[model samples]
Target: MAMTQTQRYGVFAALALVMAATRIHLSLFHHDIWDASWGIFFLAGFWLRGSARWAFPLLMAEAVLIDYIVITNMGISFWSHYCVSAGYWFLIPAYGSLWMGGSWLAKRQRGLTLSTLGMAVAVLLVSEAACYVISNGSFYWLSSHVPTPKSFTAWFANLGDWYLPFLQTTALYAGLGAVLHVLTVQMARTSEHHGQMQN
Candidate 1:
């Protein structure tokens, strides 16, 4: 039951659309309490299948589109709104690397549950670190609009303001992502077993 080229393309295209929609929906509707974007799902999909070249581009495009829509609707400047979107190119690779590493660990560990948890945490930490460093540096050094913090104390305070919410969001999303990965793997195993029994 090997997938044909057409089938593979279809799968990739469908997943890309789904990822885009999920990201836009989450960004718009799920802004309170916790934000659940296609980021985790993209990472999980890449983990399960390997490279997510299409997924990453689709995710970034969706983010940019959402930024435009939000800006137009809210009467905000598009540049200001899209500043966050600009970081996705760097952030996606950081998380994607972690996902790939996690997938390797899962393969090596013979499908242990703990391996999945470790992968999720690894993804979270890598993503947060990459985003924090890149985004903060851009704000401080590159961007003229964002006021650079004057002192070390001010910079540290700014870092806390940027990092804390990100940490909380990543923790919540990573926990959910671990659970989802486990459930998906379990279901896949169950289906395979059932198919074998039928055969």
Candidate 2:
């Protein structure tokens, strides 16, 4: 089913809101909810691929703004926050990797099929790994947060510690997104079939 321009805009807005809410909730309110920014970026790429020129930048700005607000609320400058460092700028490419993955999957997706699912999983794994490496690697090697004399073995070990949790969280959200996508496409097809029958 083809989407109208208005519908595309609606999906874009919804993705942005979800991203903001989840990030803010995790950082400020719940403190337990995993931030959905990563998943949202992927979803945004899938659903709003053509709008990336503007939408991606807009989402990135929203993320930075949320961090600024959260850090300031804690009486700390955004720049001084432990999580914000020289390596922090690497997030653009990290998140971009997820977006590219989604966009790639979107182009190859052929509805509810095993091949589609497999491709999605494969892409997600590769993209998530790339994201983890870019974000985590930069933090470990470039950021002042880490002590000098970093060893590859230690860094590899550190990667193992957090990689699974991040991947699991991203997969969980992406799985939910897959379910929704299937339902939406199925419903649209059914509606189209019924309309054709009526005509």
Highest-lDDT candidate: 2
- Judge candidate 1 at residue 82 and give its lDDT: 44
Which model scores highest in TM-score?
A: 2
Q: Give the least accurate 10-residue stretch of model 1, judged by summed lDDT.
A: 35-44
TM agreement with the true structure for every prediction: 0.67, 0.96
Candidate 1 lDDT, tens digit per residue, 123-159? 5566556556655654544455556455667666777
Candidate 2 lDDT over 1-199, as tens digits, reads: 3578899889888888988888999988876788988888888788877778988899999999999998899899888888889899999999999999998888879878999899999999999899999999989988787887999999999999999999998998888888888899988899989999999
Model-by-model lDDT, in order? 0.55, 0.89
TM accuracy, model 1? 0.67
Model 1: colliding residue pairs: none
In model 2, what lDDT does residue 65 have? 94
The reply for model 2, stretches above 4 Å from the true place, is none
Backbone clashes in model 2: 0
